[model samples]
Target chain A: MKKSIAIDMDGVIADVDQHFLNLYHSEYGVLFTKDDIAGKTEETLFPEAGAARKFAFTPGFFLTAPVMEGAVEAVKKLMETYEVYIVSAAMEFPLSLTEKHEWLRLNFPFISWRNIVFCGDKSIINTDYMIDDHLKNLDNFKGKTLMFHSFHNVNYNHHQRVNNWDEVIKLLVEEA
Target chain B: MKKSIAIDMDGVIADVDQHFLNLYHSEYGVLFTKDDIAGKTEETLFPEAGAARKFAFTPGFFLTAPVMEGAVEAVKKLMETYEVYIVSAAMEFPLSLTEKHEWLRLNFPFISWRNIVFCGDKSIINTDYMIDDHLKNLDNFKGKTLMFHSFHNVNYNHHQRVNNWDEVIKLLVEEA
Candidate 1:
């Protein structure tokens, strides 16, 4: 069997809190910044938003945000031996998902768009390894979980903590 | 405008060569396997296997092969905005690329079977981004380029080589 890696999108690949804040400002008439969202609970930010607040948990949030540091390099290394999959909670249309795959293709051509997965329940993505920033996701992930340090998730530690692609590659490659 | 991500099947996601090689070895007199067909050049491997080679390159190649890693993630990411398209080159008829897409949906549960593109030339994809393993396809791709790494391509270093999902996430986040 081949080694597989499933990475999260939001805080791991991009700083999606600002995008969510912007989205909330437009969608639910709320205002917040990345700094304000960090370490804060959902109820604290959007006491009235309810389900709309859950939109931040979706893959589209990160898919539409800016890039994070060393994200590209980390994905490149994982693709060499493992079947890299993007298991996110985005529930939008297939067309939008396809566009993000194309963007990844253009910027990181070596990664295969075919293996990408866009779903809410990541537990279904049965893979050998996973890298995620959400403590909830890391807690529930069925595979060997690697904890990616997030700006707000610094306190959520336990599973292996990796700061960059170098550390991630070292952990994954060392196993091989 | 929204970001776009173009995906190719066959060798990128499905092992069409292996599918055909197995079929040929079992049906015809050909005795090639994935290892025999993957690393070697066409001239060295198929001096007498022209018809079989052509069949393999055609759409019949996507018969029941698996999706590569991180394909689901990347697709979900791009699907956030742009029209996610499956631009593939397959056999003309009943060996329909649509069938391959149907199979893909069953495995992925993320991409829609209808969003598939089963054409010969991706030049019409005019997409903002394209992900394909074929080096020749680089000429046909518009916008940025993301090259999938193959074992045969040991020295295949280009401006945009994405061997893993880290590279893919990095590229998408940067572009978004």
Candidate 2:
């Protein structure tokens, strides 16, 4: 039987940090280079206390977020061996659900809609492996945790960490 | 942490059976009494081989489905003790995602969006209890399975069955 892998969307497959960083620069004239963004939490990186809520509620935020480096190809490659399911904690923003759905369809045309999970809490996910940026999601997952590197989770060292799609492929795909 | 209960939307809470019956009569002059529906599968109940695909693809199908008897109250009551999650295998119909989301919001207003899960396969769901109509969903569930009675699953008697929302409450709520 093919082992199943649950992948987080926002900060892992989608370049949410870059999206927020670019938006932060354009919205408030606050510019931070990619080098400056490392090890910073969303709260510390953005000026507004509830910037995530505001940005997520924005109509085009999810639809237009840049895809992470090599995410599209890496996911398709992983499907050869694993039942790769894209799990995104997207329920909080009602508008983002359809937007994320559309984004996945447009960018990851190879991904079947069946493999996409739009949920609120990732704790309910059951898979052989999970790759996520948040501890709240990875900590509770009943699987091998691969902490996808993100500004918020850079300091966390509990789970196996993958800095990019290449690292993920090396750890999961090639190793297997 | 409260024990989680995954509730199927189509046949369990939302009355897809009633919706299809009404639509079938209006669209093709086909009629079936609720009694006539018992012990019949989707293939047997509808004339067309692809009736479910056709009906699900039809615009506003999930949104217009009637709520099963006492489902709203029963789910709300279950939430007091269980983390009631509305789990719908809605990925096959992309058009139905937002529609189902809106349907739940409009009908079960008390249900938080956080408690909703939109996915393709029910196998990945991790919860303490699962209430669904299809064996495909309930059979592999690690949790205690409560087969919500529907015409399609009335004959397959592997799991404990609940004929209506009242029976669901009796088996899950009062028994607890």
TM-score of 2: 0.93
Positional deviation of B163 in candidate 1, in angstroms? 41
Q: How would you encode candidate 1's per-residue C-alpha lDDT over A41-145 as one tens digit per residue?
A: 555655564543576455464346666677788787777777776655443333334444544555556654455554434533456788887777777766799
After superposing candidate 1, which stretches have Cα over 4 Å from the reference? A21-36, A42-63, A92-96, A174-176, B1-176
lDDT tens string, model 2, B36-56?
Answer: 888887777876777856887
Please name the candidate that would achieve the greatest TM-score relative to the true structure: 2
Candidate 2 per-residue lDDT over residues A66-161, each given as its tens digit:
999999899988999999999998888888888899999899988888788999887789999999999999887788999998888878899998
lDDT of 2 at B160: 95
lDDT of 1 at B69: 66
